[model samples]
Target: MTASDDPVLTEVTGRTGRLTLNRPRALNALTHPMVRRIAETLDAWEHDPAVRTVVLTGAGARGLCAGGDIRAVHDDIRAGGGAASAAFWRDEYRLNARIARYPKPYVAFMDGIVMGGGVGVSAHGTVRIVTERTRLAMPETGIGFVPDVGGTHLLALAPGELGTYLALTGQPVGAGDALRCGLADHFVPAGRLPDLLTALAGRDVHDVLADFVGEAPPGRLDAHRAWIDHAFAADTVEEIVDRLLGSGRPAAQEAAAALLAASPTSLKVTLAALRGAPGLGPLEAVLEQEYRVSCAALSAPDLAEGIRAQVIDKDRTPRWSPASLAEVTDDDVARFFAPPAGRPLRLATGAAPQEVPW
Candidate 1:
């Protein structure tokens, strides 16, 4: 798709419908409009017999998607809370659920910086492709936000304590670690993505798999695995942070520093959400918890401050409310899981997991 028309492009290639994120300059950070268009196109193609499969990727080599348009979401929160912005999240989460349960073979080339909202679009696909350039994360805590777009669900599904570690610390995992954690299916080199996509356009999943000709890069996270597994094994975010701080390992120390820099309240609530999420009744239940948390995040002092410092001001120093994790009470975290006055998440029923397209 050309940049002139839409940031997201939809094209039919044989029986495959390709959705390309087309904002290279911004690393294809998803705007609300982009999400809407993608959802609309997917809805159209879902039941269209003409389209047998769907492939989602980005336009440039730099990244697949950096995440949501946090600036827009931040602006909405600043304006005021009402139906308009609330509806955007509702629709976005619904799209996420639909993608998770999409009937056709859905393939996501999770090339780079597939964090936050980007994870929503690509992680739930039948096939998740990782490349050497892929830098996958769920870094909402850093910005006073809980991981949304059904990220909690995926995090819950990740191996061992890695999900909690990621939620609390916002650490980036490379392709090998992503594969180890079940976030990605196959590792392919960046240079070969086009030819693979070209081959995938006219063929079946089996054919596409057969055509793949790339080797996995050397794993980067192996040395830190022991620390990651142990430190994040703590029951709470505070405990995890404390353990990391005391570990004395350089990586652990750096990670602790990063966590300390994030909004304390964000860390508290995100940890609670990730731990509680796995037992939630369904994806919608988890999303409802996330929605409540997200709305509450707007009201909290840190969100706007984080956005101002990080995006608007570009100052890189947010003065977070409840400046330390110890100051954030459990009650504060609990409020986010509670439902709003009347509206609740309207989730779809009858979702069943399908075979992962190899």
Candidate 2:
């Protein structure tokens, strides 16, 4: 493939080594090889003193990444019970943990449309920048999947029940709300990102950011905190919905509607995952749990069916089995936390290969 034709393009300029996701046509949706490619590049860059800071940016004006190539996972499930898809996630989640603890500064230009797998790659970095154009979410519930790639870890840490609300609704948040949720560090206007990126090659990240960073637009979460915290603090999704519906708040009722439409199994599992995250110790531990939940989802009917409705058919109407929260038994949710038939994700044992941090 020509340089521009590669899925991921890597280049070193001055002290900055940049990795550009090149599949703008797919909104740089990550493939298994693309995941491996990024991990491998980080392996090399981590030890290269010349490459002081590693930068990740997308090649398009549309977004950084849409998510993982889930249609492939759908096909993988249909053909072989999702072994290949599970393997891809195992590696992908490892990469997420690597980014969180990477010794060198790893900067992500989270300009637009960061969701699912997209959130995994950038949000973990030591330096995550969001622009006015940024739209970030962990919209996996809409696809009959639980959020993976340490998403549960980040969302669990969001203030109060904001994490629970986002986990259930799968809504995209702006740069302001992203900052509020601890998903990003600095807010640089979209117009100034090019200038900020160019300066990274020569100056320290903190110094370059000071020149371009601006106050984030006010976020909505702070205003709705009282109702959100109250409604979403319930022990179960059913109660969470009951509280939201009874709150007499338009926005909260809307969130209830969104939850009603999501896959019941996914919604329940996702809640369990989010609730369990804070106790999981670290991002690596949370990822191991997410791996089990994700692999279990492969066997569930909703995953393939969800992808079919939302992606393959573009119908946006998934007929979820177990239809409602009440039908999703405690047994059903507990199964997701169990080990998959395949090997478990073993990330926390021993020293991780790339723990050097600066």
Predicted structure with the largest lDDT when compared to the true one:
2
Q: How high is the CA lDDT of each candidate model?
A: 0.81, 0.90
Model 1 over residues 114-146: C-alpha lDDT tens digits?
A: 988889899888899999899999888888788
Model 2: lDDT of residue 24: 97
- Report backbone clashes per prediction: 0, 3
| Model 2 lDDT per residue over 43-133, tens place | 8998898898999999889999999998899899999999999989988998998888887899999998999999999999989999888
Query: TM-score of each candidate?
Result: 0.93, 0.97
Query: Which candidate achieves the best TM-score against the true structure?
Result: 2
* Weakest lDDT window of 10 consecutive positions for candidate 2: 349-358
Off by over 4 Å in 2: 349-358
Candidate 2 structure lDDT: 0.90
